[model samples]
Target: MRLTVLGCSGSVTGPDSPASGYLVTAPDAPPLVVDFGGGVLGALQRHANPNDVTVLLSHLHADHCLDVPGLLVWRRYGPEPAAERALLYGPEDAALRLGTASAEVGGECDDVSDTLEVRGWVDREPVKFGELSVTPFKVFHPPQSYGLRVVDSAGAVLAYSGDTGACSAVEELAQGADVFLCEASWTHDPGNRPVGVHLSGTEAGEVARRAGVGQLLLTHIPPWTSREDVLAEARAAFDGPVRAVNASESFDVVKSGSAVRRQTS
Candidate 1:
């Protein structure tokens, strides 16, 4: 499977990137988009038809899922609209949160049933989409959030941390995966930041080291945060390959015949 970085900015849209968003795709399967935050819809249009993909949100935070409502517009009113309702998976309250955000009138959620088939994710239960199986793992975040472990028919695994703090669940989600796309929102300054919110680059690398993941890809670095600072922190913690991913970069993920790790830029 191929993973594309549509956006990696944290908390809010940054000057150089959008909020958190990633595109995962494979042969003959519909594109699976994770965390459709701001600017993702526009970025996705560059690679695939916006109406021909499945969406999965990690949480209801505005930076992680605000673009979903924009997607509804394209699928419903674009030049070539969707032929059928597309599937969207998120936390249990996904329907309510998305609908409320799309609402035009005050205190009313616009009915998104017109173009989206919203589904709630059950923790650890894998949802099959053709050749891919997506298992959502509960993570530390506001409202409801998850870390997705995607496996292809070839048994190649791609794990995403999806904006989590230092938690054992995040390590479990990334255990022995090929590419661990984890978040490192800021520098390693515990006293300066709040806990149970986001992981530092040091924490992200520790998770990768403990889980024995193949490659560690740090993401969700806000524009204000020094990229080099976080990169140094991760490298100091993990001797394995660790890269600070950027917007529009793509990675080809594979396995050595099984669930062993192998990746290419």
Candidate 2:
């Protein structure tokens, strides 16, 4: 399976990168986009057709899914409009929230049912897309959130920690994954940071170490956070390779310690 980093900035759009978004694709399986945050729709055009891919949102935070409305626009009026409604899998409130965002009038949610086939993600239930099986694990985040575990036909696993804090469920979702796409939104500061909302770099590393994942690909680092410090924290905890992913970077998921070979596109 191929994984692409559409954007990796945390919380908000940074000067260099947009907010959170990712692309995962494999042969025979339809292209899957993990999130459609700010600036992602434009970025996706470079790699895949927005009208053809299935969208899986980890949460409804603006940085993680605000651009989904843009997708609705493209699918409804683009030069070549999609033949069918776009498939979207997210939280139970996804349709209501996204529909609200797409609303044209005041206080009235747009009937997005026509433009998108909104579906809710059930915890631990595997959703199949030809060669790939995606499972969502409940996470310790606001209203509702989940980490996605994707396994290919060949057993290559790509586990995305979505936007989560330290929790056993996160580790379970990442257990034995070939690539652990975790979020380290902050440097290690337990005393000041809020609890059960986001993870520090040290915590991310701890999760990777505890899960025994093959490779640690850190993401969701905010612009204000120190990347080098986060990297140092993760490397100190995880003996395996740990990389802070950047926008446009791509990886080939493999079942080895040295898995996820990076390529700049």
Which candidate should be chosen as best, given TM-score against the real structure? 2
Residue 71 accuracy (lDDT) in model 2: 95
| RMSD to the hidden true structure, all candidates | 2.2, 0.7
**Best candidate, lDDT:** 2
lDDT of 2 at 9: 96
Alpha-carbon TM-score of each model against the true structure: 0.95, 0.99
Worst 10 residues of 2 by lDDT: 255-264
Off by over 4 Å in 2: none
Residue pairs whose backbone atoms clash in candidate 2:
none
Clashes of 1: 0
lDDT of 2 by residue, 125-237 (tens): 99999899999999999869999999999899999999998999999999999999999999898788999899999999999999999999999999999999999999999
Checking candidate 1 for backbone clashes, the offending pairs are none
Which runs in model 1 stand beyond 4 Å of their true positions? Answer: 257-265
